[model samples]
Target chain A: MSAPPNRPVFAGLTSAYPRSEELVRATRDLDRGRAGAGAVETLYAASEKEVAALEERLFTTITGGYLRWNDLFRPIAESWTGFSVGPLTRWLETNTFFRQPVLAQPPVRVPGTVAARLPPVLGQRPEKARVLLPGPYTLARVLDNRTGESDGAVVARLGALYAEELAELRALGFGTFQFTDPYLVREPPDGVLETATLDAYRTIDAARGSSTTIVWTYGADPTPALRTLDRLPASVIGIDLTEVEAASLPAGPEGVGLGLGIIDPRTTLPENPVETVKVVREAVRRRRPSSVWLGPAASLDLLPTKPAEQKLLRLADILQALRREGVA
Target chain B: MTDALFPTQEIGSLAKPSLEELRAWQEKVPFVDRLGPSGPDLLRGDAPEALPDLRAAFAIAFLESAGLDRVYDGEARRIEMYEHPIRQMAGFQFLGHVRSWDSKYYRKATVVEPVRLVRPYHLDEFDFVRDHARRGVKLPITGPYTLADWSFNEYYLARQPGWRGRPQRWAAQREFVVDLARQALRPTLKALVDRGCRTIQIDEPAAGTHPDEAALVVEGFNEATAGIDAEFSMHICYSRYEALLPALLEAKACRQWAWEFANRDSGDHDPYAVLRTLREYGDTRSIGLGVVDVHRDPVERPEQVADRIRRAASYLGDPTRIWTNPDCGLRTRRLDVAYDKLRAVVAGSRLARAEFASSRR
Candidate 1:
């Protein structure tokens, strides 16, 4: 599975960045893990170890850049719901292909399969790419029917399930997984759902055979939420630049990757590319992550079909440029 | 004056109607007016028993004093959610609600599935407003295209209809929603028009949601308003108006584009930057410039509001084509805050008009 011949010209990274064979190998390795809590959290724990012999072996076998971003277990763990997950997972899988925009019950997993399917559609995007899954809180908020259930019950069950699935992905081989929990901002000031979200991350951390970065995208008005955030075992927290004023961001995270989402994923308006590069550079100067992954606040689901394509191209351009600057 | 406030049939006061109560709802005095540390509109759904009620007409005297050409009962009779009555009806099915990221207020609404329109305005809801409303009232209703665009369509009609069947259910659904606009909304507009209601404001918050899909919705709206000759208006705000920018210049069914000039995307206090964007389209329709801020509030100074209006007039290149308004609907604000905000808008418009006349001399 060599990279496709028709891969679009990207500006930032090396020409070899879009290697299809490497992506396929990474996908296969990622698919081999067990489908439970231990597998998921162990991935998170293993991610925390500093480039140890064992960690190097795991990252090397996974192709490259494995322990970088958060939500590594998601694409794999959420997929198991195919047999044991909620009704939405079944609906999404049964009706549409992984990336098809139809809304069904959203799946409970990371959608690694969707990631694997993207190279062909995206024309061999960066090899060993990172895929993002909705964070626990956002999942809880949007999927909740609130008929007879409390948010904690939902988080606990899903967390246990996520932990097992995340551990499985580590065993299989995923470079980075980004978990997005935007709903913490929407949760009641002193609510149980917020507590359960942190608990779920801890469960995953304890279970993963090794350390992995847990990324939180779209956390804004980050107050009260950020108070408890640094304590969570996850590695990185992705903040939304479009939603939260950059001034509101905390001074620094101890060792977490600062996932800065500078692009607007929801609207079709093209971002000024120069301004985008400047923002990323400033964040690098200020936050100084061990690494920084540039992307949008969320998926480009709401954009029109054509504009969505343009958005992906723009993002690819940004990432490529960042790689040239050695930031990724 | 038509006797009612809303066109629907579910007449009842969801909240008390009072001019003074509407004036006090702002969280801040001048800047940062809408959202507050304690939160805005938190005291609703509670009762007040202590203060002796003022029985006279003087209590509401400020409403007319504010100088609104057309006024509403400020929707005092209705509660927070606007679409509840439609949802409570037998046929409409419930879909989960969506929240505005900026404002925590939730709009609980239903998806009209299987696509059918049975009747016009709920006669029951409109009758009371009809009886008690002031003269020449403006009637507000959500548009049809917005309803279809907001909800998820279970079927995309991807399947081609064979010999016994028809193809492209999406096209059919689009037509269905438009037909609903014609059957339900159009008649409601006509009823108001027939009753001597001179101005009707149709609120289409969802219009800007999908810019590419806008032209499709506009066709339906155009059909709904074909040959009807009342002063027609469309109110939209808190949105990036760029999507519908081209449509505003087409001079179609709407005679005025009543928009929020002081929203997050529109900029905080100064609306000139936003009004300038619509400069090229000024000749197509009147600009319902929101001179007063509605979100947070100390009432805007007459000078500040007047300044905004003058900016709109300059950018629009014509003072006559610019109308004064608040950025968005005041239903979410406190009653007192809303009244004060409206007062600033009226006073501001007067100052702008006076300035224009002096300049002519």
Candidate 2:
């Protein structure tokens, strides 16, 4: 069977050299002990400006690399330790400087807020590409919930919000969306979580025309969720070629597209072209996936700056080789 | 903080309870309850009525003679860590299902409504120990980052800028955590401080997982200990400490940082070069060096515990600042084994302390 049409391999990039401009400015102001509202505003303004510039720079790729929009929103959350979702919501609604989308859902809804942020950020890039997300399974693994909500309830709501956001993204000219689920590798996901997640994806997939490839990334064995994968209406399912242990290859669908995450984003280990070929061969032998594409398992945020760029170049090399082998 | 840290001791974890003694203790101890699948009953906190009997147990057992300085109420009353107080608090939903964060092999923590400590669960545990132990008692509670790391992420998942829904809920939840820290942790710690809980060792196995979020974890701890004047401590073990070391040293909230030194993987030695690297952070805090390995089959002797403590002490550059301890908490151990190990800890401390004092002279 012929492989499904694959999206271009997008690699992460670094710009403005060793120093992040926002960090430098924040550090400088912080060093001067400027702890006033002006300092805070200046720092945030610089971050907003840098983020916009980053989106432009990523698309431009001065280094001749494909762009991966990784952790742009996450860093905003990370920098402010005091930033809880509650204050963030209040901040977005109260501030006039924060522009609400003209052709967007109301900001009161979680998905709408995600929708409002997407067009500006995703729209900035002219490239037809897939977007990355920490999926419901993974997102549930990383938060503190003192709000008396069950983890299931929390993840279900998030999945619903994500489905809405994914639907909104499809409307905003994004064709291929990759949902990054790292936590799935932690044994088989619970049956209930798996069901909710599959349902969420089906909702998003049906809305987005069944063409978007939702890729699960990071170190995980997908054998347990293979049934869920078969039923979910996505066009392609990305597998981490490196971490999808050969023993874990489950007997599943032949038509499902696969995003083979072969590159190591977190380490400086040079990608051996020979070893990679062997992995790709194994993936073909077992899953016989519609398409087996190679990329990083997770975001470059987990890596130090130097290793990230090196890994990106390795990805570029692998992409060229995979095309030559007629694997795409 | 005092110059002295964790004194070397026998690992007081699983004491082999003969069938007869087990039955006798069960009948005698009012709260002889078993928790989880593993059968070590939580003993001291809520169960034992008074300090005198606990002291008598220590005296009869010669726990002090064994060289153990810090004592626990055998986790006597606690059903599980973090859940006991959360169950007591208002606005908590006990989901009734116990789920492991990763897999069952690593460790298991219950999922609950985001926890804020309104009252200290370990209070009764500490009070019983304080009333009885001739030496200082170590207070154990689940650390803040562990609380944050182990909870559900619905409140923290990726947010869209205009989407304010999850963020609003997250704010409320975080408020509960911070408020819990303020109301429950602060007062409990202060009460322990007042009750002469000289060495307050907060147990935070969760901190190691999200070491990248060290600053936030440290901030939470600092907030918890804002106006307290006790030798604050933190114990984490059996996992990667590399991510947490930098943030912990940077935070400097705890006057002492204790961790497991020996394990099957670590080969009965200092796991990482933590003692040597700890000096890089400078010498403000004491090190509760785990000389006794709790996970190992054959119980370690006082001399073996002493040797490890000596090595850690040398690495720490201050013998006085080194405290000896088990690699982890003894919640997994049987009562007989637990008492035996604790006795070894006390003995080991005497050996190491004598060695250090003689060397100084």
Candidate 3:
């Protein structure tokens, strides 16, 4: 057979910069004794500036650069107007904190709340932008079970809300959408969480029409639930190769695209571009991929700004390396 | 306020302004500029030329403004919780920055050599507050397990063994941390006791970060506080207190356990839900109830604090077993927000005290 197709790599699933920037602004505001309702608006404005600066910095890079939901507090519950945002809460494993959106009440997507809040600089470059989210299953996992409902019951409700959120983004012309399930790797799939997640993916993908929908799984092994993940009606599915043995990857449909999280984001150890190319190349050969995307196994929220930035550059280098090697 | 009701106190480092605030203060304040780039560094043992002792005196006065039954220096001189202690100890050196939570980081130190005391770290800082304080003063020190928990174990990774050729890294943390508690903290506790520091609060924010490691934490606390005669109090924030309660009860040296109940209350506004958890483990240790939510800027209503305390009292079955405090430290908040939260702590404690005393009559 002809040389395997060289995949596109997106190096922008980064949480290091804007969250850091917004945190600095919160610190500045708090330091200046600027407390109360007005500070929230000011924080949002400062966040927009951070976005503009982030876009301007990443504008020259080849692979697509993302405009992140930097101030996204707890995953799903923050969609409601009443779920007031709190301090930068601790993230599991990584040293980074995300403004965890607290889901207190039944989540109803208030108008203007769910819309993408990119600053004009990135907002102008919609082609390069893909809206990413903490998939419904992951969002519902962190939520406290205050409602006395089953996990499936709560997940289903959140799934519907996520579908709505995705539809809104698609309406705004965000053609490429990603829903990341970090918890998929962390928690063994309770049957209900998997089914609810698949349903949510189908609802969003079907509603958004022929747009490219990528369900990127990371941080834990989805090996047990791979078939369920692959069966979801989406254009592409990303698996974390860090958790999967390259040789044992099962054969799959050539039509469904592949996104390999070939680089580890949790460690300070630098990645070898030559080795990264080999990992994806092997997966492509065995799986017979239609399309391939290379990237870090998860969000680069674990690394500090300097290292996270370097990891993004290194990811781009791997793509260039594969292109030169021909069997890409 | 009735003595039978639990008394309120301030936790360590009550929202010290971010270094950003210190930089701002450095630019404006004439005397603090001489202390260094960060004005608060003066509070440590290393202040240049002993800068007139004004800041430590002000720390006591600032806490006195809150009217807490017990007060602390609010850790004005040191950096964030873990770094200050590591800086004072030998063998530990800053390798680089590590993320603790979202965007917040503490300098990750590696214990490359055997740890020893640079000297007694908290005595002079404690003495200033003790002499100047109008309220009873509480000196808060970083507990050893938390110090080990937040650190990168470079030394232990090399030295400790699980079996043949395999270095048991997890077990290594236990030994290294227990060593830090038993041997490392001895000098500071002795020095503080010698200086007549009666109330010692061990700040263990990392105590419940990992639920499985709860037993190790208790072991560390017991080792760290051995033979020090002062009253021992412990502070833990944003953890699964349910998992920790059983293991933490083993820290008999720790007379009271302070928790961040108000901080837990943030996501769910349910008033009774958190105290409901506290009531689950009945009558083992004096529970320090968090009435003020320190993470948020909004000042708590006094009635809300009183109501939370009353609910805690009913469930735990003794009002006296309860103590009052803010959910966590005020370090990341503004000075104004920090003081206001303390005011709520005092005001709410008053409300609860009055209600309890009247009901008894």
Best-fitting candidate, measured by DockQ?
Answer: 3
Question: How well is each residue in B1-361 modelled by candidate 1, as lDDT tens digits?
Answer: 3221101111011135343343342222221111233222322223342111210111223344455655444443334324533543233443322223211213333333444445455343344334443333555566666554443332322222321011232464476557556665677667666666566666666665444456656766775676678777777654557766676455377877777665432222243665666776544576677666555556788788777776666676767677666776654455567667777777667777777778789
Decoy 3 TM-score against native: 0.73
Q: Give the docking tier of candidate 2.
A: incorrect
Candidate 2 lDDT tens digits, A35-139: 554765455445434444543444322211211112323421222232232110000000001111111111123434443433243455524434555565555
lDDT of 3 by residue, A256-322 (tens): 7777786565443456666567767777777776677666775664444455566766766776676
lDDT (Cα, tens digit) per residue for candidate 1, span A1-328: 2222222211111001111222223333444442444554354333323212221332211212232221223333335343222211101100111111111332345434534422221212222334344565555554423234565666666677667656655554544555666555534324676678778778877775544555554524455566666566765666655544443455555555566665553333455566567666655555555555555554433333244345556766676666566442
TM-score of chain B of each: 0.72, 0.74, 0.85
Per-model TM-score versus the true fold: 0.47, 0.48, 0.73
- DockQ result, candidate 2: 0.02
- When summed lDDT is taken over every stretch of 10 residues in candidate 2 chain A, the lowest stretch is A87-96
DockQ of 3: 0.14
- Across B1-361, the per-residue lDDT of candidate 3 in tens digits comes to 2264768788867444433444444343333432346545664445444433545545565666667788877787777778888888888867455445433556666677767778778777787777667678788898898888666565765564321111244567787787788666877888889999988888787765566678888888888888889889888776657766567778868888787777656434453354555556554667778887776788888888887888788767777888888887777677777777888888888888898888879
Error of 3 at B141 (Å): 2.3
Best by TM-score: 3
Model 2 Cα lDDT, one tens digit per residue, B1-361: 2245445432222233333454455554422322222223333343433333333343323444444655555444554565655554544443222212100111112223344445545665566666555565666676655554444323222222222222333453355446556766777778777766666677666565434456656766877788888767777664456656677775455877777765522332245466677787665576777766564445778888777777776677777777677777664555556557766777777777777777779
Candidate 1 differs from the real structure by a C-alpha RMSD in angstroms, to one decimal, of 20.7
